[model samples]
Target chain A: MKIKPECATCIIRQIVDISIEVTDDEIEQFRLVKGCMPVINEEYHNNAVPAWMGTVIHRHFKKISNCEDPYKRLKETANDTAQNYIEDVENKIKNSDNELDRLKKCVLATIAGNSIDFGPFSISEDIVPMIEHTLNSELKIDCSKELLEDLKSAKKVLYICDNAGEIVFDILLIKMIKKYVNDINDIVVAVKGKPILNDATMEDAENLKINEFAKVITTGSDIIGIILEECSEEFLKEFEQADLIIAKGMGNFESLTEYNLNHKKLYYILKAKCDPVAEFIGVDLKDSVLLSNKQLQKNLANIDKN
Target chain B: MKIKPECATCIIRQIVDISIEVTDDEIEQFRLVKGCMPVINEEYHNNAVPAWMGTVIHRHFKKISNCEDPYKRLKETANDTAQNYIEDVENKIKNSDNELDRLKKCVLATIAGNSIDFGPFSISEDIVPMIEHTLNSELKIDCSKELLEDLKSAKKVLYICDNAGEIVFDILLIKMIKKYVNDINDIVVAVKGKPILNDATMEDAENLKINEFAKVITTGSDIIGIILEECSEEFLKEFEQADLIIAKGMGNFESLTEYNLNHKKLYYILKAKCDPVAEFIGVDLKDSVLLSNKQLQKNLANIDKN
Candidate 1:
């Protein structure tokens, strides 16, 4: 489904909002949007930084009486601003010899990655155990007959990742998917297009060497759920052909749920990371994991058998 | 006030942290030397983005420890990542016609600005009103006189600004100074050299056309108080000759107070923008104007007159 322009803008803000240490309430504002991070990238293509600056500039600019596309104008300005900053950093890097100094700048350059608003600390802490229980037990697998049968028919699999600190786990999931899928090419791992939040981007995938094993793609949308609307033609084609899509983190769940995938199998694997999502799924966000019924049952039985 | 290396690094991280929104207090839990931001910036020459990514690469590369400068290695990798992302955005901008589309990209670019953490919205909100009060009041005129007097004898006036949203006000302050001082060459408005907590950054200043009036500067330091140690020689030279320094926000107050300035006639004119700083000065952060005793008395008397 195509995302509304306002919704898309809001989602873009939301994804970036998530990576920061902003209050849980502030972060919660973004949680309302599904699949947040991908939208931010999508919005970028639409709105430039200087254009974004134009919005702030709008307040300063006296002549423009009616700003029909304030978001657009602001974005263009933000783009100009960004380019200048990138140049500034480049100059700094050219002259500096201090390792610690260089490292801080690299980290600062990776700023968007850091803005992942985790929401209230309490909400974040509260839901971890439940999500852990689900991912560790109900979401785990022993290659059950029913699940394997389903997997045999699966033509392709898309694994969407979230958060840099948690990226190591995503690699583990990719490793697990290789066990179920025969065609390596059929397995697509979608990291962030850019470092919108502390999630693995295409660069991160290359750094982590995930690109070595699988074709890495960014959803081109910032929302957590699968945004069919913003997906590039290439991404969309893969998504359309995919038999199974495994979305990691709350962002994927939110964006994916907005659309009607009909019979396509979609699995959301995330520790209810925030309250709005936890409440939506009828589980505590702190510790709950929402999974495909098939994955949940198979993993639960495997736990029972073990 | 020379910023310590540890403090510089921390401040740089804080600036980046706020911009990227790295909230997990743990992410900020770095070993301090003096100035976290400046130390890191010095080591890398103000290129912290690559440095930040290097830290992550260091985390992984250290497993084998073959690379001589893991940080440098990481810096190279981050450069590749940043370049790719930059190219991607440039490509999109090249392809798109929608002004709104470009605006989104601009916002994406300013993700660094977005990452800057203001701690909590509540904290920022609580203190902003006082600053607004001072800005709105006639009492501001009295302090401006002292500030202007201090600036007149000085070769340069370093006007430190904070908060991106609040920067508009800083512009007004700079305008006031320009109107009174008549020496546009002497005015230097230093924003965050890097993005931190939505503070007025060099990029923001540029976008806002801050340099159109004054020489806008950013310190490599991220200390919360008056950060002099992390600044460049160009800035330091101005600092040395300055008859007066006007600090605009709470972070400056926090970072600057620790180091003793040899009777440099520093005037910190901010509405008690935070509780800790307000408490530090033994005033109500919510309602007080932070000025020297003489300026404070004059401001209060002016308040009574009004």
Candidate 2:
């Protein structure tokens, strides 16, 4: 599951090469961007693909020494890089800062809106189905009565969220939780604050309207983990006190696994979106479905009745 | 320079797309690899490109989702995606344990065995001169006799290095210095340890043979920086005591600039590989090559005479 260094460079080269196809001029622009480098050698790809793709063209052009007709190669690379970049941008916009949100908006508008209208781009037009599937697969939960009971008795809940493109789903889930729960004050939604390339920063969480629903907090770390390396002591204290933590997406799963909270309640809700994570959880990576804390969901109903 | 989230994503996309183009089996292999995923966007371009091309074929795949060849479109997207995957691999390689030492062996083997291949990529033969020119221009230095005299008075020197691709050049430069200075014991080369995605880790430094001629130390951080974020305080204290500190690459430059060194000795050596760093140092981005402390080089001369 670990990445080889050669493969890492190869991926970067491919990203860079593709960007050149779109426009080599952007290569320099991309090289200057921080956090554009991808995460490597882990069980899951997580943030690796998108972070490297966004500004990869320039490096490719430079690598090829700026060929006279780099379009074919550039175009080829762009498709690969753009797919990952879009995922990452969406994640950042949903979970981190305004700048990223704005940039994501601009980029989406360009690719899905303007660029598609004028040039050759193969992006899907209707994203709703994907959204639905992502939610169904990535955000499904066990809605049994026992689960509801556990929810009622839970002292605190932590919601760890994912991609900007998918934030609407998260918001909807939060609203649903509010309707079911009596004390909304006990819920905490954690989001990104500062931008570190494509990773969700604290600023991203604010824009997604996640802050409006609960106690929103930002941990300064670029990677999603529960270690408190980037999160302040206060945040860590809050995390420790929470009765339940619902982590969404692959990044959080990758970094937080080390914590393995035995004393506290926890739930991992996500689509087997990436391979390494799925492998870790012993699930099919391509299941195209959702999984929840089946036992917890059952328990919640019992607790709620009491 | 900090990367804008959208731009970063875009670059990643570009790389992912290109990777798919390299091979068809790689696609299935990629899926098998950790973190790989198929494009699940609802707007799958089925009609844009031809199917025979598998993932790499293009004409069938238009840039538009509505294009005629869905297969080609998918292939192009795969190509872009491949790039992203490659980066993931490279990051792992760079962050591998004892990367510097490993790299040293690789480079040495390549140079000695005349197997200087960057994988299957032969590159445009012209890229070599361009890269050479870039390194030469960016790393240029003009040391004065007076500056050499000043440095010769110092007791030690510390070299903080950058990427694996460029470490060979650094080694060459180090050898040049040893020829002139008799106090080889004073030289210390610091590299990164463990893996941190895109940054040059301590493993990379060791692989590159930085430990052979100088005292090698690994900063635990994934990226290169001067403040020693991951290194122990004892290491920091030693770094502070060095008569000269030669920092290589843009990462170190960015992290080191904010420090208040007072009258302490420092030497920043790097190629203005990107624009912002060039602007920061008042150089042109297109001008390739690396630079070093002009005065510090001259200062070493007086030590030889003494």
Q: Give the TM-score of candidate 2.
A: 0.34
**Measured against the native two-chain assembly using Cα atoms, what DockQ does each of the candidate structures obtain, in the order listed?**
0.01, 0.03
lDDT of 1 by residue, A180-284 (tens): 677678799887553332345565566668876677888674333444665678788777788887666655665566555656676665555444455445555
Task: Return the lDDT, model 1, position B223.
Answer: 32
Off by over 4 Å in 2: A1-128, A134-147, A180-182, A197-205, A286-306, B1-306
List TM-score per model, in order: 0.33, 0.34
For candidate 1, give fnat to 2 decimals: 0.00
Candidate 2 chain B, run of 10 with poorest lDDT: B112-121
lDDT of predicted model 1:
0.44
Candidate 1 deviant stretches above 4 angstroms: A1-306, B1-117, B120-145, B148-155, B220-226, B293-306
Q: Second chain only: TM-score per model?
A: 0.53, 0.52
Please write out the lDDT profile of model 2 over residues A274-293, one tens digit for every residue: 34445445557433322345
